[model samples]
Target: MMYKAFFNALTGAALLALAGAAAADDLVLEDAWLRAVPPVSPTMAGYFTLRNDGDQAVELIGAKTDIAGMAMLHDTETTDDGQARMVHLSGITLEPGDEATFAPGGKHLMLMKVDTIPEAGESVEICLTFRDREDLCGDFPVRREAP
Candidate 1:
């Protein structure tokens, strides 16, 4: 009986955590970092693991960042022509008690026009909006890219 009660309490805390920040809320970052690129690159992408922790569902709406001119949701899709292309996305849905990985060649955040190349060990702040737009607002911080 005591063990059961303890488990319940632990579950409740996890739920509350999901109720908080979006990025580290239900999801966790695994070796998360920004991509290093040339000054001429129009955009860069951040990669991380999005671990779902709730019992319902979640979606990624939009993103914001000061490190770049613009930050938005994006995906790498394979076209019928046998070519892979980068597509901007409005949002993403996640199953309750599950996780969705936001990484290269998958659902990810598109950061446009970086003014500076972020140094390693630095963290970039990003806010992820959710579909519900009510209980979902995640702030993502990733280590800067390495050489």
Candidate 2:
């Protein structure tokens, strides 16, 4: 009976360790926020950081938000003439243990045809669809200042 009890305890401990590891491998979203545009502006921007801790790489394929009629991924590229332009991106790949950041003057989400502009301190739900992983939905706060 003592031997059986020891085996059971060891099994339980192993299971707990596995669970902890899985939790650590989960993807994490940090500092999600949207830039507040003027009421007359037709477009706004969204930014965030996506961290992947899992063993496999993932691709961000698309994004959607109710606040805008259309949402798309974009990258800001500077030309030789010192002019910057927005380039649309179909998807962004992030390797395991890597992170992607969306910020002003860099990679960002273009929110076009905004139906309404949320006031500062309000939150907008943005759903990010992945290529092979489950989608992640985050509530991004509207802020005038940089994140």
Candidate 3:
């Protein structure tokens, strides 16, 4: 009886581990980093490329970080007058095998009212939430200069 219970528990654990692995394989985050801002600056920007490897589409709904009071998705657009303005986005969608890049002067994650200014070479934790996939949390490096 003891052997049977132990075997069942191990099997359950293995199944859960496999499920987690499969979930993680659905999405990939690459080259995540936070652009360094001045010590008294209230906002910073985070850039990354998110790739969806699954057969279905994924929607990046939002982002959050402990180091910021609020995080939001934004895009830079040119107006009729040729003035560049920042626009807020509700969410972004990615098709299968598609990669969405968040870069400076383009689409980016805006970190507002930062609690503390992160130093260069520091790693900050940011969580990206998707509509139908598991949240992706990564340690994004802080860079003093744009690459």
Candidate 4:
């Protein structure tokens, strides 16, 4: 009975480990970084390229970080008067093998009311939520330029 219980437990642990690895393989974030700003700045921008490697689609619903009061997806667009403005994005969908780029003057992550400011060489944890899967988190390096 003891051997049976030990084998069952070991098998369960192995299955869980495999599941985690599979989930992580479903999505990938590359070149993620947050823009460096002055200490007094209230907002910061983050950029990254997200690729969907899963067999199904994934919709990015939102983002969250402890360093900021609120984290959200945003996009820059030219208004009817040709004035540049920033707008909030509800969500973005990516099909299998699709990728999305978040860069300056385009779709990006807007961290508002930053409570904890990370130094230029530091990094912060940012988690992005999806409609079809669990939240994916990564460390975004703070930098003056793209990495």
Each prediction's TM-score versus the true structure = 0.66, 0.81, 0.88, 0.88
Over 1-147, each residue of candidate 2 has an lDDT whose tens digit, in order, gives 999999999999999999766744577888999998788889989999999888778898888888889999999998899999999999988888889999999999889999888888999999988886667889999999986
Count of backbone collisions within predicted model 2: 0
lDDT digits (tens) for residues 59-90 of candidate 4: 99889999999999999997789888889999
Better model by TM-score: candidate 2 vs candidate 3: 3
lDDT of 3 at 39: 85
Q: Which stretches in model 4 have alpha-carbon errors above 4 Å? A: 1-13, 79-82
Score residue 121 of candidate 3 by CA lDDT. Answer: 88
- Sort order, lDDT high to low: 4, 3, 2, 1
Clashing pairs in 4: none
Stretches of model 1 off by over 4 angstroms after superposition? 1-27, 79-81, 133-147
Q: Which ranking of candidates, highest TM-score first?
A: 3, 4, 2, 1
lDDT tens string, model 1, 1-147?
999999999999998877655544455435456766665777778766665675667776777677788888778888889798888777677787666677767777788877875654556776666676443333344444332
Best by TM-score: 3
For model 3, the local distance difference test gives 0.91
Q: Write the per-residue lDDT of candidate 3 for residues 42-89, one digit (tens) a residue.
A: 999999999999888889999999999999999998788989999998
**lDDT for each candidate structure:** 0.67, 0.88, 0.91, 0.92
Q: Relative to the unseen true structure, what is the C-alpha lDDT of residue 40 in candidate 1, on a scale of 0 to 100?
A: 72
Distance (Å) between predicted and true CA of 116, model 1?
2.2
